[model samples]
Target: MNDKKKKSDTNSSAENVEQHLQELEKADYERLYYSQEQTFSADELARSINEQRLTELMAKSDEFLKSLNSELEDFDD
Candidate 1:
């Protein structure tokens, strides 16, 4: 029974990840990636993941989002 519960929990978590991915826009890379050359480049994405460039990715994403949000606010004015 305990093993069955563990399996069920793992399956549910996997499903949630799949659902979240499905809900995301396929063009999100265009917004998140600042480099024109790396946009939609599978090799670059693989390298980033394999090299564990988490901090770099996080910082770049944060910067783009901040600029995008500020632009949107100004546009709405």
Candidate 2:
């Protein structure tokens, strides 16, 4: 009888744990799917703008390099 009671208690505890886990999973799913989502917070927007400016600078640098390469090729007679 004592062994049976111990087994029942273990099973009850396991079921309770499983129920709590399920609740947590459901909450997570709801948050993932239904949460109000904004892609760009203010800090994120500032970083994006900075990156865009850096990319424009890099493109200008590439164009300058190409022009310099063409000038060098012209002198390779």
> Top model by TM-score, which number?
2
The most accurate candidate by lDDT is: 2
* Candidate 2 TM-score versus the reference: 0.37
Return the lDDT, model 2, position 75: 93
For each candidate, give its TM-score against the true structure.
0.33, 0.37
Q: Estimate, for each residue in 15-74, the C-alpha lDDT of model 2 and write its tens digit.
A: 989989999999998898875574768887686677877899999999999999999999
Q: When superposed on Cα atoms, how far off is each prediction in RMSD?
A: 16.8, 9.0
- Relative to the unseen true structure, what is the C-alpha lDDT of residue 32 in candidate 2, on a scale of 0 to 100? 88
Candidate 2: worst-modelled 10 consecutive residues by lDDT: 32-41
The 10-residue segment with the lowest total lDDT in model 1: 30-39
Q: Cα deviation of 55 in candidate 2 (Å)?
A: 6.6
lDDT of each: 0.77, 0.87
